[model samples]
Target: MDNGIGNWPTIHRVRHPDRIALIDAANGAELTFGQLDARTNALADALARKGIAQGDRVALVTLNSPQMLEVVLAVAKLGGVAVPINCRLQAPEVQYILGDCGARIVFSSPQTAPVVAAAVEGTDVSEIIEIPSGEQRAAGEASQSPYETLIAAGSTERVEADVAADDLAMLMYTSGTTGFPKGAMLTHANHHWNAINNLTAVEGIGPLDISLAAAPLFHIGALGIFSLPLLYVGGTTVVLEAFTPDAWLDAVATHRVSVAFAVPAMWAAIDATPAMGTTDLSSLRYGLCGGAPCPVVLIESLTRRGIRFAEGFGLTETAPIACVLDIEDTVRFAGSVGKPALHVDMMVADPQGEEVSRGEIGELLVRGPNVFIGYWNKPDATAEALRGGWFYTGDLATCDDDGYYRIVDRKKDMIVSGGENVYASEVEQVMHRHPAVGEVAVIGIPDEKWGESVTAVVAVKPGADVAEAELITWTREQIAHFKSPRAVYFVDALPRTATGKILKRDLRKRWSADGSAVQR
Candidate 1:
């Protein structure tokens, strides 16, 4: 009888319809549980009338807004797959996803309508509905709205679709450093359990916690980490239009944001913000970092300010919350992602799927209700990854004697030089120690003698500088000399995905095409 997450707001409305469910941080608009349920129902009916049926793909190309979440739930209500495209991606990139998914209907916001309009030109998208925005957005560009205009036109009755737990809910594409994006098919069950896993894994989150959605909502981290968990518990979510160091700090202080999640880069920006020291972060109970290896220094910095900062390891395939460092052990076990999350079965295993010895690095494997079903339309890839009912996360990690796990490096990101294996993350972690480094990504350059040479591409902080030789020597002192960067390249900024992950493949291709980009 349960219709998965589509009916969550409906259930919560019965308990506390007046409780605030969502907030638009940029415009100060709010939605209560009752309002959210009615709106999602109405939107679902509107979408159904537009011919969106079970198994149909509905693509959403927009920024973080309450309307975006509304669309997500509305599509789920119809048993339609919601495909979220990164708004930061260019037209061709957006076109690739739309063409690949063959989305029937496309949703766009004023800020991203131009890109969507250009991208959907040759796709199967029959209708492109634009959500209205304030006049301040997109440099005062005008936008036509038919989506919001139709929200009140449909009936509020629950439109039944027989939507099941096993039915596909979302087709979240993986934004990797290499290759084309692959859609990870997540079921309603995956989302339902991700929320349960989060509620059980993190100790303090409850009905009153207000989580800040700063990271790109298209990514699983910002959605599955806390936002949906809060939604499940009748809590509030304040959606940010876009992320900035000052905007994030101000939102936390103004909205009294209690729980949040960010990538290492965002955390560094917050640390760099001058107001970080003066900001009142008293309302925060805890925060989480993911998408990359979180530097231990960031954790220590926040904990010293009486804010609980924890790091975890997860992927888009796991509905993203596979494990987390407990609040009590955050400082004591600074580097490890800690034990597997509740409801998740984790192991470090060999290529044959056999469990490896503790302290030995191997592929981290996960199996849980939260894990995604498989990659959409890629049965071969799915079979390879989902062998034996366990998703083989290509992350190399080790389980310590105390049952904690630490990710060493991604399988594809590892570098081999002079027959020695080098993890870019390890080198990058030590590189982050430099006072002048703002962001950095380590890669391997082709080398005849060593097969590949370790290299670092760095972006120095504003008003800060570091010499190439000085940084190489600084890295050599902290780690093995061979693992240190043989070449250093400085740029104004490191290229990143919408989720704040440095695009190492793009960097590799850029330097390969232009030799002058390398300093050493």
Candidate 2:
């Protein structure tokens, strides 16, 4: 009985080999527990034969597919670190991550092969594996060896590696808000306990429950909280390559998905879709909304339909789940993110790191086995973030006497647009590169659809002309499209403090006061 996550598939294979473990909704493919276990064992052997040793980093830049899941499990079995890249990232951003992580091998789908090729051109990545879709290529039209080929050629005999609970399992990259994205080193224990917390948070989940993975798999909220936990309990996971309202609703109705997790924006979009009303969603037992503050109205709407919504709070540094608004408390604590998860300790602290009184606003700090070990190769950042044995979440929150916690504001300048984290500094850096831009400040403004929309307030250079559309387009080309500003506001000068720091709160107020922010 291996104590690490690497053995989960093997355990389930022995217990329930005939159970369906995964269902690829896009292609209508299924993988039983026995099949998944055998495939992952073969893939692990193939990776070891390719010189991928324990503790080495392997990057996967592919969409939602069974192959992606296979790669994740295979890496775990090999005692290697899995770095799942956000498929929406631009080439430059992807290149930066690959270089930073020192990944020796990268697996990308044919759809994203061009971007992956460009990103790894100058990086340390030595081997590139192309995961082809089920469609077979014509004879003599073969390119690089397909993912299936590796699985077919390798042996199914389990490749055992010395793995422990404390060993590093994953390198989850945070959205680089200030500069480059930092990799949060999550151990096997961190992920194991996180799965336990997720299971405990939502009671009554059993082997018969089916979960939907509609959100991007790169995110911990989707993979860690939803998919992995369900797998631990021998439930089936239905995966979608990308989120679409029609596809999500259809999967739920078709697969009888009992549990699902999505960001607030996704929930909003699903509600707007005509299929949402027509589709039979009675099979869904509950759903989770997180990544940004979910609107109370959205929660109420979903709850009215008998789809219980559990809002949660956490970060990449905390294995992505520390608190969850259970279904029982959703109505009573309508606006809260709920109390700390099982075995997780949370506190509100002042600037001096002292715990604040109940009902007082302060930074939220968490301590638990699920907390990540530290940022990969970033000692200073790791030390600063994990001070006094607590992970500083950089979120301003208040805890009521009833123990419910509500987020007040963000201590860090981050924008949560459509459930994706866009660091104000990362967007501002690209905006400043425009020749006509003299100064730029990025802030998140309240949005109805997206929890918060990324808005850029800019001051044009003297005697230069630049349209808002052009600036937005320029920024999109530099980073992921989601991080690009959805609205642009022109200003004569930005308000700054005596120390020459731009007052973002004032900019947010100014934009809110007047209706000058132009949304595209």
Candidate 3:
């Protein structure tokens, strides 16, 4: 019943104080609700003293950790926007985001310093808070103590912010498949309602459940689906810096992770790990799979292992939780993404924005409180995306007679990274810039894990020879690291039709045949 720009910190503090809140499953560091709330308050005060006020955007460049969660909560408490930057992005790409979002403060690990430094070189960012690398002597000493220590040493004057339900809460950048990255403006209400709906839809996952945050915290799947919902119900979240088959299994077994969510790529890797077969996975009771299609084989494998796997579908614009398949639907619908959330309205639409009938593949359009406000500062694009009170998701999906939906393919060339969208055209443009490149097309190839890996096919100019490594290095310099092609192949001529259009479907078929091209 609570509305009006839900107070995130209040939600945690008032419900359960002594309950375990978050754990760095990698290092075994744990914090209760009261302790986590206190840490976030200190961070909020620090950001306020540094002049980050209401509506200002703050960039978080750390990996999965409790500190990452602290800054996100602090930003929300102060009515500022939290911009979760992809840590995999290189310097120039990171710079583009810093400038694009006009963030005032950036928190990054040593691994991201060079990239953060390059991005903030000409910007107005006042502070660059470093997360201890445990490698650099000076940085290590500086970050040795807890972040709460630094906050307590500073003044504690509370900075009150005037936040409205419509104000932006988070700015999630879409992977630039076609062009420059666009930051989707998700409101606090969008996230709050999405979490409530997801918690209800998932069944039996409430206040006492423990969830895994193994995916990149920068992704909505990790942040929204798992982390936010756990925080909402005053449950526990276990953070893992990165996923390894052994590490993920260890975390699940040791931590007793009851509700776990992972992208298909993570599942495939864990499934393939020899150690996975021997691990005790009985503690895992619920599994949520998204970021790409959940293969029937993977679902069956998890089910056989005593884990219930359900399919989910969403985009950054919907606060990323639009539809979920319940446990009953998982068996009935099988591969379907299930039904829309109770408060959400979903339907397929054509190019003209008219609703299409069942069994037809059209762009999925959603309308609800969970829908985002718009893209930051991009009025024309926002107008096009949100029309007639619906957020237009450029994803192709079909609904069966039973109201279950299944995503066929993205109408836009979007590639999901651990549950984040990466547009193909955006990366292809960067690859085409190379002097030796004559023509290029980027497509997603099937990976046993990662669901789809970014792959590029290039038609080099005659008499110009470019090695795979050279193209990889050149392209990585241009875009975010994840957006770069995982593998590159050069051909005398690209497969095309008689009219001269590149045949992407054929290209994907050829590339996925063996998966042994030059991988960057």
The candidate that achieves the highest TM-score relative to the unseen native structure: 1
- Residues 125-229, model 3: lDDT tens digits: 877887654233223353454453557765433345677767788999876544577999888888888888777776746878899988887877778886887
Winner by lDDT between candidate 3 and candidate 2:
2
lDDT of every model, 2 decimals:
0.87, 0.83, 0.77
Compared with the true structure, what per-residue lDDT tens digits does model 2 show for residues 202-306? 564678988998887787777887688777778899988778899899999999899888887688678768888789988888898877666566677788877
| Candidate 2: regions farther than 4 A off | 134-145, 413-520
| Per-prediction TM-score to the true structure, in the order listed | 0.96, 0.80, 0.78
Clashing pairs in 3: 177-423, 177-424, 177-425, 177-426, 265-450
Candidate 2 C-alpha error for residue 365, in Å: 0.4
Against the true structure, candidate 1 reaches a TM-score of 0.96
C-alpha RMSD of candidate 1? 2.2
The alpha-carbon RMSD values of the candidates against the true structure, listed in the order shown, are 2.2, 10.5, 11.0
Give the runs in model 3 whose Cα sits over 4 Å from its true position.
1-6, 133-149, 155-160, 413-520
